[model samples]
Target: MCGILAVFGCSDNSQAKRARIVELSRRLRHRGPDWSGLHCHEDCYLAHQRLAIVDPASGDQPLYNQDKTVVVTVNGEIYNHKELRAQLKSHTFRTGSDCEVIAHLYEEHGENFVGMLDGMFSFVLLDTRDKSFIAARDAIGITPLYIGWGLDEMKALSDDCERFTYLLPGHIYSSKQGGLRRWYNPTWYSEQIPSTPYDPLVLRGAFEKAVIKRLMTDVPFGVLLSGGLDSSLVAAVASRHLADAEAACQWGSQLHTFCIGLKGSPDTKAAREVADYLGTRHHEFHFTIQEGIDALEEAPNKEEFHQETCQKIKALHLYDCLRANKSTSAWGVEARVPFLDKEFINIAMSIDPEWKMIRPDLGRIEKWILRNAFDDEKNPYLPKHILYRQKEQFSDGVGYSWIDGLKDHANKQVTDSMLMNASFVYPENTPTTKEAYYYRTIFEKFFPKNAARSTVPGGPSVACSTAKAVEWDASWSKNLDPSGRAALGVHAAAYEETGNTEAANLMNGSPQKRLEMLDENCNSCLIEDIVASASCGWHMFVALWEKLLTTKEGNWLHKQNEIVPYKFVFLFSKTFLKGNIKYL
Candidate 1:
């Protein structure tokens, strides 16, 4: 994935405005940390932060047609780019990027260029010769595009498309008068009486294809496993997808998967097993609850989490850590989340709630349909026992105590009197909880009195939903808390049943060896060496530890610490020498 930003129809000083595009694009570097490119014409500028995933040799983007007429900076992968290339009987190919097809297609099909492929993408193509531009987002919005326009006299877009525009998923806009028109309309959403019936077989087929399609990348890639069904299935599908791709490509890529959690967090253990079963080069990272607490005030490892769970813990975090400073091999490295893609969700949102509602049918997790939409061979990331597992909202996964901790922390910092008179603090959405008030306070730091504030939907919804879903469930009205902990039985029953304790067994032998490697780990020591040039001890330790523990050996270190006779004995002796060490 990459971050894309653009300023089109620039009647302003186009050359001087180049810096503005770069400045705006800087805000999105968290999304595409590999490299960046900006293409400026007489009237437009397109900027890209690339998370290169395919054809890395020539995949530096703002990838243009042979003559450099149509230029594009894209954010997602086109898995079927090879096919799309074959379909182009005439145009000369440039880079091996799944993104390059856009320039050629724009040259041939104009705005209609959007419908011919399968992939998750948000892109801006600027045509100097053609004197036109086109922008669009992926079908299900798996990728993100925020459209904005501001003329000083009139504002078309706020900061992050929060002002005047919305997420234009699966739609295209042209500078040629016919503004934004959607091209990829799934039969389910576009047809008057959509007959896209729920066939387990069809759904299964589509889901697998969606995952496989999204896996198109030329760089090292991995999964974001939350241990929930959505993340798990995504990880599973991704592991398999990478496996197949690697095998077919000879000596091309190694599918490395990554996951993050707090110390002893539930997701870490669950993710380990999924990684091993799929035979991926798995990496796991651990953070303390205190660290998560600290992250609340920092920009996420990447940006963009609706804070659907809480704060900072997000898709961008894993991506930033893994590829932030790295470039891709010939194959570009892309982080794929099948569950988040638009093509997949289009089917999901269309199905009736009864099909997805947890109960005897599937149990009441929201993405139930997403997990079951796969067959056995297609979905091995989770065992069937875990496959149909109900959702665990993020607030709960961080720890049952996480929400309570956040709320308690918020209460201490943001007094009840403040919430009692929240309307004064926020006339809109009127801060309901102490935690919200805290986030709102921070939000004000970056965005103070924004027109975009209106774009962020308010009013009541227990979890992530439109207000309508909350009205359907009476329990929501009675409870102010939106943590998934409310769905007690679901998480309880899954852990109680499949409770794959094997994942926690990392400490036995291999884990210690892994930790021992930390003593010599190249990635860690290098980071330490770099940090020594600046920063501080905590930064060095945190950075080194991030790389160290993401390895299996890292888990072993955590395990080794448990056996006091070994690592802890040394720790105890060291502490014993320090007079300040307290015996509890």
Candidate 2:
């Protein structure tokens, strides 16, 4: 990742404004420490800080087209630059940078070229001939971009200040239109359930391809294994690919995997197991609880902060893209997440959502389908326990004490008076706890403007559940903390005995019992009541079948099958078979 900043249509394109732009852009220098470039036109300014991941020696930013009439500054890797360059054969390129292809493409296709590029990026392209500009971000907002308005039209175009607002992901802002327009809209955004059949091999192939595509970098790269299913799967696929003779010839070594946590943390231990299994060169970094607090206290650059926040809100589909990027990029290492690969995501989402749901009583936990896919006895991808490990939030996995320590520190710093008057101090998102108040206080120090604060997400998040998820359980709305532990009753209750075993047993019985219960209680039954009853009844049906089969009723099965309609019996048989059998 790199840093990009630009201003267009400023009333005063004066030396002072240019200098101020340079100084403001300096705030993002950490994101790109290798090189810096600036492009100042008659009515606009664009600046870039280069991280040097691709074409390190020659791919500096503020790249230009053949005639230098179109200049562009980018803050992301263009994975398909070679293919794009192949399409733009007639255009002459100045630098070997993958990003340089963007300028030529813009020249060739104009504003429509943004969709042709495949990668994570936010860029500002200036049409120096007309003094007009167009700014756009990646389809998923993997690269951060912010736009701010100043006191007036001229000031708005001139100011490169912290007061800027986050540029919406998958959007384009043009000087000609003077507003934002949506440029990226996938069909899945409509919340349509896919009708594709669940094929494990197809799903696996898509994921493998995604991992392969992300391996386009010339520099050394690694996977961030948090010991979670998503990260573990990414590590697994990348390791398998890296083991390929061709890939090994290119990378020249085993894949490197990294994980960070407090010493002896759950993630540290789990990540070690995965790295060892993958035969990766694993690096485990430990930070003290105090050190974690200090890092948060020493707030990083503004661009970094904004990018992290935007990634969480917009890229919820991927879930861990920003975190994985931020963690690895901090050390100048490019991280790839196979799970977020576009092809992998499309295939995974196409599979019926029912396959992803957790059914603990049936020995099917969260991501059970994924675990079962790789649960090969002869060539297992991961240890059974590791494959089936319960999910843990990143903060909680990095030693529970880390979050507890932060809360303690926040409590000590933020007085009761401050929390009580939180609304008045910052009404946009009133702080509900001392921890939030303390953090907001520090955030306000660097970004005092309301727009900056608005960029940050607020409101109660229950166990990573979005606002819509609260509809699944009303009690979820009562929680304020985003930590997984806060969803105590919601998840824990799923395993608890509902204290109505009679009802449960009746529901769990054979088709006859289930029909009787539904007929008896259909008018007043709750979903939980029905689910509990059905689960118990199913187990009971299996036990009764075994008992009856051992008796003189060995022929009872055939008789029952004959009595029940073939189609109805087939549906019931499939349900019971899936619940009773252990596939992996």
Candidate 3:
């Protein structure tokens, strides 16, 4: 997890361009707050912000191939890196990090690097001597990338969409082919569909393999269990793997899961239930609607579309909070969302839209697909009701009131008179709601220049499908809300019950019946934090003293895994004695 900003094909003042790229990548400080690095040559500049997911002590970006022939900056996990490393054993290798495989693969088959790995990654590899850079985004674009051009610095790379490129994943770049090459193709995606009832076991195996492959990072890792099927399944599989490895070997890796939501949010409850069911160490952050909204407002997305900004804000908070907790390094955890994995997605997306929409035995969106694909009576982690819960838009999952708040904020910012002139002034994506206008106004303020903002593809869809898909439904035009909450007719009964404002949660059952479960886990987690922080503040220091006094169980704080940052904060804080040191 990191940020890379590359300026290639630029003409003059290479140092000047390097400075700009450094500033631009710094904009992603929230993504990779731990370390920063830069690589510069005559025509190319690459700047990286590092989040040490793999090889925390040694691995940092602007990584180079043996002898420094190839250099790259990567921003996502590579799950099959070790396997790829084994395959490319003939090449000299360095670093325990999963991403080191890219440099080696590039050395073996310059542009074939994408064919060898399975993970979500966006990267730019620079060949200084060749005066070129390779760029690519993952197959599903699960990890975001954008390309824009102020002007071409070199002979316009012919047929290249722009001198500034957003590389598509599963493809490699060269100063050679000049662009991306797609490497993923399965039977489902092709024209021949000899549907033999879509073998459930095959789908199941593919998913398990996908999950395993995505587990490649060298750092501590855990699942973000929302207690929903997707998240729970990931957590369950991960926990099972860690347990098996530990029992078989003398030791194994640790998994520490994390979940966050507004106090009393449906997600908080589900995540905790799933965590306990999996029997994994878990960290829960229960925020208020105001906290989530405030985080969104203060987040440094630079993008102005409120929906897009909100997405960036949430991702930013997740990364930052994880850093604060030191969960990644403490537990050697590298996070992956199997639900977002491309191989899994291809199977999930290929079903005829009708079958995909059916509520399996458990009346929920995607439940049938997951149940059928996993061949499970029920996922062990999710409560049967939550596993089969209805369609809740990703945005709404954060908080029901967040969308309403954003809309209200937008409304107050843009007047009816201003909306009337939108078409004349902006013409493209002119503000429909005041919320949108408020976002656009912010966007215009930050990105007063046209090129930077246009890089983010935008238009309209009931949900987040490509803008072209808008033609499939006329309601898309009638509604401006980008959250899935906009699609009430398509969602399950819960959506219908909410009059389409939000999905009705069913951690146990309908909102009316299971209101208790909906608010239970998170409220308890909040109560726990207050108590634990207070206890750790005083008792933990006393424990630290016990450790200095003797080597007994009472001194477990010293013997139990101690990372420098955690211990320093603890001992240092005792010197000041204000707050408790929170740790695993």
Candidate 4:
């Protein structure tokens, strides 16, 4: 990743204006510390901070076309730049930077060129001839771009307190229209459900192609292996590609895999197993519990998970690209992710969503299709146990002690009175717990502006479940922490009780009989009740109480007002009657 900042349509042309641009851009220097470049057209200013992943020698930004009419500063890798270059042969060559193609592509195709490129990027292009500019972000927001106006008034652009926004992913903004517009719409976003049948071969092939495309880098590159399914599959595919004759000649050695955790943590042990199996040179980095707590105090946690797979996919800019790039680029290394590859995403999304669910009776775990696709008996990709390991949130994987330490530190720092008055202190998204309060206090110190505060998401997010997923189980809405462990009991009970019964019956009964039993037992009972039973045994009490409250003589409500205990009436109506009626 690189840092990009540009100001267009500003009338100020003084050297002071140039210095101010550089000064503001410097705040993002940590993203790209290798080199810096600036371009000052008649009324536009563009600055770039280069990380030098692709062309180390001459890839400094503010790249231009043959006549210099078109200029661009980009922050990301273009995996298909070679293929794009082949299509635009008429354009004169410049440097070997994967981003240089953006300049020429804009000149030929204008803003429409964004759809032609396949990679993660956020870029700004200026057309000096027309004095028009366009800025765009990638499809899935793999890169970050903030769109804000000058706080100080600009004669050509805006007055004070102009509306500032984060550029929407898969969209573009233009000076000509002065508004944002979508550029990367796909059919899947439609309301109609997809009808494509699942084919394991097509699924596997697409993923392999995706992994292979990301291998197009000149510098040393590696995968971030968490030993979970997604990262493990990425490491497996990358390792196979690295051993190929053409890839071996290009990269010149075996792949290097990396994992970080506290000593004796599950992630550490699992990652070690995966590295040994893949036969790659792996590096395991450990941090003390205190060190992790300190880092959490400084950066806080911003991890997100897929509700369906229960797998953690770190949100793009804040966590993956910016954080991962900064850590690795310090050692002159670039990290590539096969899971985020464009082709891979489309293919994966095209398959029926039902196949992604965890069906424990069939020994199908979360990400079951992916695990089974790579489960080769003749030449296995990974050990059976490693392939079936449960998902763990990255922060928890570091060590449970790390989170416990944060809670302890927060409890000490925040008084009960402060927690009671949390809304008044920071009303926008008031902190509910002491830990949240501590992190928010630190966040406000660095970003005092309202726009900055609004960028961070608020409200409940258990195990990184999407807002819609709260409907999956009623109790999920009550969860305050987003840790994976919070959902462990629910997962274990659902699979263990029902799954074990079905497996046992399979030995003595027909497959059809097993299916019928599973539907009758699992579907009729609400999943929330199943989880509630596992967690508190509350479902048993509720069921027994409901049975006692009912009678064949009259409506349950007629007897509820007189004979039933008040607490029993309330519980019965709420749990059994759907809270529609209340007994006096």
lDDT comparing candidate 3 with the true structure: 0.49
Q: Which stretches of candidate 1 lie above 4 Å from their native place?
A: 9-16, 149-164, 190-198, 247-256, 279-281, 299-334, 340-382, 487-584
**Compared with the true structure, what per-residue lDDT tens digits does model 2 show for residues 106-214?**
8888788887877777788888888778888777665556676311111122234555665777788888888888887665444455456667777766766766667
Clashes of 4: 0
Measured by TM-score, how close is model 4 to the native structure?
0.77
TM-score of each predicted structure versus truth: 0.71, 0.75, 0.69, 0.77
**Model 4 spans > 4 angstroms off:** 149-163, 245-247, 299-335, 488-584
Evaluated with lDDT, which candidate comes out highest? 4
User: Candidate 3 on 1-584: residue-level lDDT in tens?
Assistant: 56567767777755665666666666555456678888877767777777775576888887888888788888777877767888886777678777888888877887765756677677878877777667776654535454542111111111223334334434444557765567655454343322334556666766676656555543333455556555666666667676544222422455556555545555566677777776766666544333333332321111112223223222321222222222221221223545445666556445443333334364534446565454466555345666566545434554455455545544545678998888887776565666556556544543444443343344554444434345546766577775555755754433123222222342211122211111222222222211212111112212222223243322332333235111211101011111101000
Cα displacement (Å) at residue 555, model 2: 72
Which whole-number lDDT from 0 to 100 does residue 477 have in model 1? 54
lDDT by residue (tens digit), candidate 4, 438-460: 66765554456676665555655
Model number with the top TM-score:
4
Q: What tens digits encode model 1's per-residue C-alpha lDDT throughout 1-584? A: 56677776666755557767677775555445567887777767777766544665568867898898778888766767788888898989866777888888877877786878666677777778766777776665544455674111011133434455344456777778668777766544532332244556656656667666655543323454556555566556655565576433632344455555545556566667666766756666655434444433331110111221111112221121122111110012233544444555455445443454345443444444455565366535467756655445544543444455445555657876888998976887676877667656654544453664543445554543334444545666556664535533545633221122332332210111211101222332233212111111112223333355446644643553332111110000000000110000
What value does the lDDT take at residue 376 in candidate 1? Answer: 61
Q: After superposition, how far is residue 580 of candidate 3 from its true place, in Å?
A: 39
